[model samples]
Target: MQVPDVMTAIEISTPGGPDVLVPGKRPVPQPGPGELLVKVAAAGVNRPDVLQRRGAYPPPPGASDLPGLEVAGEVVAAGQGATHLIGTNVCALVAGGGYAEYAIAPAGTSLPVPEGLSMAEAAALPETLFTVWINLFERGFATEGEWALIHGGTSGIGTMAISLCKLFGVKAVVTCGGDDKCAAALKLGAAAAINYKTRDFVNEVRQLTGGAGVNVVLDMVGGDYIARNLAVLADDGRHVSIATQRGVTAEVSFLDIMRRRLTLTGSTLRPRTLAFKTLVAEELRATVWPFVESGQLRPVMDRTFPLREASAAHARMEGGDHVGKIVLTV
Candidate 1:
């Protein structure tokens, strides 16, 4: 394959809204040591991209200034110690630089695009999958036969959480904004879905779990929900915060935490070291890749936009009506 000297990438012209994402020309980056240069076929659109576009989450130092966090494509070149991966299809969790025709990826954080998975689906997996796996299962200690309370049941992370929970035998009870979204969640194997707009989720969860409460809460919404989330936890339950979409600060009662032996934790993946992400990639390849290869697990794809229309893709994600992952196809 003839790799181009220059390629098109979506750059944040200014921090503002979707319109701030503009296509621009840049030199095609060569992979560094232990890295692969991928010809991007598709890139996943994530909420963090929105936050970055809005000037909230800046890329970590020494990372690309581009917005995308995940991409799936063919490896066209490789740096020393990573030459074996050249010519293979892969999906990678990148810190940045995914929204482009050519992007560099660390070989360690890249996973083979397994059989039966489309590029778009592969692109969608890394961010949400790594997030849910680390926070919900590893950090929160969710196990088989346990119950998990997940918010934003229709979002990429929520939907991935539901699928993983279902596959691992954890009953997932999710909250959505509307009846239609709730129905979608249930149809996607959620044990139960609560319409938070119409009902109090705390009460509904209590009823659904027969007053035992959930074993873990995978929360993306922060603020007042933190207190409410803790209230609905079973004895020794865990609360893992991944995002603070509502707000960051919250007032919680330490007495309640002490009484229940509850645990609260959170993580942000972007700033984590490449070694950590590489380890996560290896874990997923061993544990979760089988499901992906067998077609038993797949991302819920909502839509795809052309590479030039990155702004429109961001708009669709922000509109809040899409039920699943959005992709930008090159």
Candidate 2:
């Protein structure tokens, strides 16, 4: 296939609300060595994209200014060493530039789209899958037979964690904003789900664990949740933060951490080195892809928008009523 000279993309017009995201045209990005040029069918709308539009999270230096984290498409061309990927359909975790018709993906960060998934569903996989595996399974060590407490149970990451727990043999508990979301989380395979609006998450977790606490905590709500999150962990429990939806600054107690031997860790994907993303891709292909193919691990899609209607998609995401992943279809 001949790669196009120009492509449609979403650009942040200003540092403001959802209205800032505007459809624009730009030259299609070329894949460099060890990369693939994808003809995007769809892109996943993520919280990071929202942050970037608000000018809270800038693209790491050298990355495109476009706002999107994951995409699903067909490889139209490839760089010298990545010719093997040409003509393949794939889903990729990109640093940026995903909200476009044509995008470049480092070969290592792209994977074959799971069999029997729609383009929108495949587009929803990369960001949440990568984030969940790294935080819940790797860093937090929420392994088989252990217990994991996840915040934002209706979110993309939360739904992934909850659904995978059954397949992985981990007991998962979660916090959601409403009764409907709590029910949704449970239906997706959570052992338990708490409505944060009507109940206290810390108390529910404590009760669910018989006061022993969870083995790991996957939290995005930082600030005030920190102390409570620590309090709800088992001895030596791992607490991993991926985002700070509430606030960042907090007052932590050394005594609490020292007494329980707790570990608090967090990570952001975009700024990491190419080698790190490549390694993550390797790990996912080995450990998670099978689940994806077997129908055990599946994407939870909330809604989709035409690629040009990206601003409306941003509004939907910021509205916070949608559950699971939102996508942009080209």
Best by lDDT: 1
lDDT scores of the candidates, listed in order: 0.95, 0.91
Q: How many residue pairs clash in each candidate?
A: 0, 0
lDDT of 2 by residue, 198-259 (tens): 89988989998999999999989998999899989999999999999889987889898999
Candidate 1's displacement at residue 292, Å, is 0.4
Q: Model 1, stretches more than 4 Å misplaced?
A: none
Span of 10 residues, lowest total lDDT, candidate 1? 109-118
Residue 242, candidate 1: Cα error in Å is 0.3
Please report how far candidate 1 places residue 267 from its true position, in Å. 0.4
Candidate 1's residue-wise lDDT over 10-42, tens digit each?
A: 999999999999999999998889999999999
Q: Per-candidate RMSD vs. true structure?
A: 0.6, 0.9
